[model samples]
Target: MSSIIPGTQNALTAWQPFNGARLSVTSKTSGVSSSLPNSLQVQIPKVVSGPIGFENTGYWGIKVQSGWTYQGSFYAKSTSFSESVVVSLKSTRGTVFASKAVMGISTSWTKFTFEFQPSASADTDENVFNVAVDGKAAAGQTIFFSMFSLFPPTFRGRENGMRIDLAEALAATQPSIWRFGISVATRWKWNETIGRLEDRPGRPNTDGLGLLEYLNWVEDLGAEPILGVWDGISTANYSDLSTWTVVPEADLQPYVDDVLNELEFIVGDAKTTEGGKLRASLGRTEPYALKYIEIGNEDQFQPESYAAYRWNAFVTAIGAKYPDFEFIATTLPSTALTPAYQRIDFHMYNSPSWFTANAFMFDDYPRNGTKWFIGEYAVTSTNDTNTLGDIPSGRLPYPTLQGSAAEAAFMTGMERNSDVVFASAYAPSFQHIRNYQWTPDIMTYDASRVVKSTSYYVQQLFSTNRGTHVLDTTPVSSNDTAPLFWVASYNNETDVVFLKVSNTGSQDLVANIFLGFTATDFATATAISTPALSPISGLFNVSNTLEEPELIIPVATSFALPFSDRFNYTFPATSVTVIALQSTTALEV
Candidate 1:
């Protein structure tokens, strides 16, 4: 288990391959084994005068703290009898803190253990763990190595684990739910991700983010998982985009079976079903955390007739077995609503101006149909001048303060109408910087560091400070050109009122907040503001920026007239402000 809170490190794990590990070899030739699976074979043609170092490429964001010991080990075998290998943890500058020598290496696998405690506190994201050959080796002498595991006390101290710093950063956000397997929806098959890690086929662009790992991440975060099952649709032609369609019934039935079994594996316990039994073998005896099972990913590309047929078939089959589970349709069904289809997904990727203007997009939406799930949404504005057209081109835009403020404005609308919008999540939630395709990601990170975008802070603010119910608030006066967006929600349990306000204009404006209820006295008021007009550092790009002024910083400038029932505050230009008011008087039951 990780020491960090669960669900926080959703993007920590990656495929552990020799190349991916970024091993640096010197005076020794090393390559992955072809005959022996998961083994790295090293051969020294001639012994060098100095120690031949085989250092890891140092991409694993390992943080070495003073007085903290890290226990690690690896399996090694040498062709020559009684040959020894020296293992040590070293800083990027080649300063060794700890070392261990293993003797009596034979043909069979032998585990070698070592412990390292940094002499001084250092966060060496590019540091390497090295295994150096001390002495000369005969011509063509071979050494086999496998399962090179190193764990620096993880978040919850899970055996094979996550980086603590990254985990801590994510847990701070307090995400309520996680939606997984959406980007790879067309290619992802649930069965391919279960069982042993090595046995599963690798996902394209994703560094081995299997189903079990995803579930464990969600479980760690204490958040629910929304699984996006693959819709049994295949594309026949690449040039002709219209060639994609649902597979034949014979093939579709097997795909449906796979999805059903996946559900069983998730929600079933011991003695429940075959998938459940397999789940038990994987160490989870009880059902894992799963609530919403999305039928497909953006299924609107396929013919409407076939898409409807596929949706009906999947819903009918899954609903029959797990009647309690709620199913989310990828697109609005062409036909009438079915009991199985509890929600419909809505995706939006528009400009910053468009998002701010359409803050109340869902206000007029009919409540007679399926509920709304903002499954994927982000403001797709680019910093590059060439990419300013209707579509994206050139370098993508970093998550700017302007974009985040616009999103915050839109989110206030969503919260005000939370009854209609059941759940929402930002798209491209996790992106490995080296292998990312989309831009303006919520969180971006390289092998060594994780950088939360401005959009992430906005999401975090809303998720952490959510209220029990919406409260109607009327603004005394507002300019139509320089619109001031605000939403108020009350937490009855805590006797606190949360007012989120966004100002998207050049000049500041004063607004009087009217709750329109019984008389109440304000106890204390604090506001968190993200002002877009504030000058930011030039180096503050999407991948290397922190939240300015922090997400929930204090605001000491609010006035309540001595004998009045109103509170007044100045809204800064191009800013997102969240105000929390604690009332002195109690509410009437």
Candidate 2:
């Protein structure tokens, strides 16, 4: 498990031998690093007619595509063998996609690497990777395999890198921030992933997806990292109140020092700090950027300890060294703390209507002090109503077009108050189609496909069309209770006007963008909504799923018009629209 790549299925848990092969996968204590305590042992029977070995259907089935060269490595040894071993990838019907002949397997354990390209693409993800030996030659032999791995072309082609398709889908979002989703706990250790492939000392887990891999991933995506440091807070159970773990404030200095070490590894010079030296030894010479450091997540659950000392202990220690870096608090903001905090991380999960109604949530927030980090926000089927038998009967498994439209309304408000709302994101970003949490994710993916939710497209629409200045605009309604919402901004460098508008109402509304100055008459408009032909009853029900991922997505169109300072665009019913007006002549808003 220690040597397995981020996207590769590991060890011998998923491998099964071919029929008539006499080999059972299990642990052996004689080989490899101390971190990896187990090795797979295979036993071969005498008088076998065919090859004897193991087959791996990677994470269900390997998606064997043409023109992809898979890099695979393994450590193997046999008590007796007379011929070179064979490793191949093939379909269920014996369609050999790729094969490699590895030689020189002796009594001692030796590592080997192979690069093989499939002859053609497999129609479906029903392919398997096999490791076999000539049954006639080594009929009565015992073999041991450990730390085996196979990886397709990765993001930036880095070894042990992220999968190509999944990374591409996320990269398409044009994200500005990335977090590894590792938070506070003893299990959320970062040091377990750095030193070496097989000796990182991951207790019961792999060190593959560790600090370096995540940093590389963030760098590849062209995003900044939101480093979440453990703040000595953990709970054994959410419903039980007696099992929480809160390290005393006096005993938090060691953990605080560990955080400083982690920060130094990411931002210190190679010649200056021990952590930086370790990073340099691992091939990262120049330090990575460090800006946002979240002290803890949801510390509001333990407000007493957090407000009393937990927050101050870490902040004081970390701030003494890195004063410029912003510290985000997991609890509510207050002007009372001695060592001031910069931002408060907020999370919200509610029904679609609740989000739509609170679209102007930040309109009344004071902009004089601490800003906000919308750590998580999403629309769910259930509400805050404490009704009896409150189990959600028909929870929304995915983001619906309706819920996303409402969310876009809320996003417009957030953008209008960008000065106060520092950074925002749709939480629970991605999940496996088969295995996931309770909340609906922005992305649902399998081995072969990725479904970007309507909310994801909404976020992409906003992120990709961001502006430099938040221009003031008059309300579209005569009264303040209108269902339409919008925020206008101007990009100084690009000379473009970006208007993100959402029509939560059923009726289409034509709102004029009074651009205060002259600009191009034509603009590009993109929107995600239910088709015009769809019944109004099903407008909010339209969603992307595993069976139909593209059910509703942003469609772009550009057209010419005769206008200078202003333009009128119709906001579609229950939809989100992002309009970009690029100017030929200079236009100051």
Candidate 3:
């Protein structure tokens, strides 16, 4: 696995008519045109001529850290005599950190370079880069600007890279598998996301998060990619039962070929396939960490018989081609006595109460059938009045502590039933603050900062402290029904016991934990807790001004060995706690 901290690289691109550039011409008569290829043309008809400025033109914002050097360059040409243009980096307050003047401009395209180091650090997204032409012009005088490039040190120091802060935040999650495909899977064509970044057509994804970039991110995070292939089914048509049908085999064959070719591009070697050669040409000689492929996003909408037909066709073709990889069916098999695929996908989105009550949902699932993948699950409670004002009044509630605690309880169930549940991932993993369509996402961010939801911390805690084997533990009292849930596991390699418990009630409860061994068998014990706040509805909601609090901090006096054979701990009301016991002996029972 790679280090959690990423290296450095350049974070800005698309300089010519910069991706999101805004033109500000002081003179109304002066016009700016981006119709030319790889360039922006500014025309001054001599009727009115003055400085023309462009700001906020990058893909997002130019993120600058304190005491870091940023290199900038641009190409410019003028039809008139020598001209001068000033370029500078400034904060939202109009404070120029650094500036430079390109003294001479010729008729021919010329390149100019400048370097600047911000004296102070900008931890926010209020920074921007600007290029301005400040002078009176004669008739027929025009200037052309192209290939404007500015680069700050990135997370790996690679050219055309990702933001360091956001990358680090994602890596910290320690995810086992990175599943890509939300609504994008319906119309996502793999060919459109490859090749040059500038050449890719503008679509709903304006942040430049293409296939290659996503694969690189997955590789950097030490996680395998689970690519979702489009099934040539539209979301609109899937909503109507009358239109529920599968595309003919002849029509679906070409799409299946596209998916297979994509897989070849991902896993094939340089000499084996054309897609592999293309992958090598893109600077990645080795195949990616690709193992699992999903047939479609959610095929549950189709009629069961038709859906089964689609699944069999996809499984037969893709499975025959890439037998080494595992395939996941969107739903259970409809025709086969045994499952046709390796795993079945299930999704759940409900209230907090539902998750807590269903903590043991998979306890009785047959151990012999197809494994299950909880591809999407979350506790979505619609009661947060804090951020409700920001959206429409009827919008759903934000993620709250009650929801997170319930999710914690649900995750403990998953850990206990890991044998049946092979893999799972929370849905809507990322949301850009400005362009988000989903509510209660795990990670929300602007250009400069990332806000981890309370649920995010819950996932981090469980992922980092996962165990190898589940240990049997006594069930909670049948008389007391205050929404208490628990799961116990032991790691033979580490010789440690992980006790995860969640209490979603009003009153504190004392839990008598039986280790089935003597207290002296363990050397030490540490506990961490996420406490629910008062009137629980007022739980902290992640937003712009403030992120989530330190809800997952360690608790010093939560657990104690009151007797030699038993451990006593007081679980706070409406809270989730994990107690890790370091043992000298690896107790099997």
Candidate 4:
């Protein structure tokens, strides 16, 4: 929680005037620079009934917890006499949760910092980070403020770290990898997001999601990092973001050099490499366990420049140095090169029906070749019925039973082809309920509460129960899969058999699974199904929203794996289920 002030085009539009305080934005000097030019200027009115200043309802709300220290700092300059200023965290109704006062602030430009510990937590997130002054004492005076920030206790107590509650929720998922920056708007600017927060030019200290912080995040989650580097190409006619700028081949070396420097900082020896030394100076003596460096994101939009040399230029340059790092290409690898690519990343965002119908899409691929990573996949539409085939209509707002079930079926297909499909992740993982452009995100949150979607539970069930090898079954196959799809896997490490099933149609199916290997003593079944909480029609299409986050959550019960080779399970009309049974022996593949 760095500065409550948002960098919205570096404007003062985020502040709300309070108690007759006239507020205006200015392009000023001293504490300001050209990068972030606009600063908040407050003009105090004549003596009034209460204090006069500005308030920021951060990201729609500010969450305050009891006995938690809120650290804040800001720069200010006064046109006339030195005046006292009051900074506080409180509800909009004027109930102060925490308060601090700076006595007789200097008239010349100076920095002020404060630490506030609230005795009581706020009832709701309808609060504000506020600043004010005595209207009577500072009557008719003008003041300028810049570079403001406030933060609660950080995740893992890392200075300027991630939000704790969000981090904890992600940890529970047992994530295997975290994709850092995938789009052009958020191209991984390695140079701008590292070292001391203060030294990072243009960005405020609250801008702490730097490269180091990202690596620390990967470390904390016990996951590998997929670093996405910019390859000088933007989405066609996307926006005014770049005027569709594509860096010339002559100028591509600097970008290639930037990628090498980034890798050096991450995995190079602290004593031998310049980038590594810089990292060591920042107190990261040990190298981060990073290996995958993805070149660009979906660069195929402009195939001419990308395939011609852009991809190979980076691959050739970096591969010569760090040959061990596996490269994942967002675009199709050049066929001319030997061993086309180590891994390829592909994305898909379509309808739920499309996902279920195409569940076996990967099964047709040749088994022995370049591995694949489905970096992004999601069910975004009601159907492909829109007038424009591209503009999907009646999109899902949250993960519905039908959508999640469809995703599960697709997962089962991937698990069946696990050797070729190395990994897959849902696209647009998180969203804030207050404002969002994308729908059906895996996790949704607000200022204070987090809501896991039905899709989230599906992901957790599969990820937590992923086994060592796909197990072979006997008798009737579970792949009568138009309505029901399944895949059985054996975890050699734990001696457990994980059977995942997904029923995607209106009618339920009774699966009688007969394994060649003997079953273990007991078993448990976990499922995300149509909600029984209330009688809602069209159960399959039912979804979970912020108002009812737990409406369609996974339910678990003590079930049993048959003493012999067969155990029966009745798959619900629209649901995804996982059964884990202890098994000492597995059938041969």
The CA lDDT of each predicted structure is 0.64, 0.78, 0.65, 0.77
Which lDDT tens digits does candidate 2 get at residues 1-589?
Answer: 5333322344345678875565444444465677765577777787786777888877777888899999999888776774788899998778899999898877777898998899999998888888888888877777777777799999889878988878888898899988553453454667777876777655433367788898999999999889888888885555554577988878988888888888888888898888889899999999998788888887777778888887888888888998888888988876555487778998777777777778887888877777988888887763445211222445678888878888888898889889999888787777877666554789888878889899999998999998999987765421274578788888888888888888887778887667666667678999887777755444566789989888887999996767767768888788899988887766555
Query: Distance from true position, residue 139, model 3, in Å?
Result: 7.6
Tens-place lDDT digits, model 1, residues 249-292:
55677777888888888888679588889889988888886668
For model 2, state the Cα shift of residue 86 in Å.
1.3
* Angstrom error at residue 465, model 4: 0.8
How well does candidate 3 score on lDDT at residue 574? Answer: 59
TM-scores of all candidate predictions against the true structure: 0.82, 0.92, 0.81, 0.91
What is residue 480's positional error in candidate 1, in angstroms? Answer: 4.5
- Top candidate, metric lDDT: 2
By lDDT, rank the candidates, best first.
2, 4, 3, 1
The C-alpha stretches of model 4 lying farther than 4 A from their native spots are 1-10, 32-38, 46-49, 79-81, 107-109, 186-188, 198-208, 236-243, 333-339, 386-393, 474-480, 532-534, 584-589
User: Which stretches of model 2 miss by more than 4 angstroms?
Assistant: 1-12, 20-28, 184-186, 201-206, 335-338, 382-394, 476-481, 534-538, 583-589
Error of 4 at 370 (Å): 0.6
Candidate 4 accuracy as TM-score? 0.91
lDDT of 2 at 536: 44
Say what the RMSD of model 3 is.
7.2
Candidate 2 clashing pairs? Answer: none
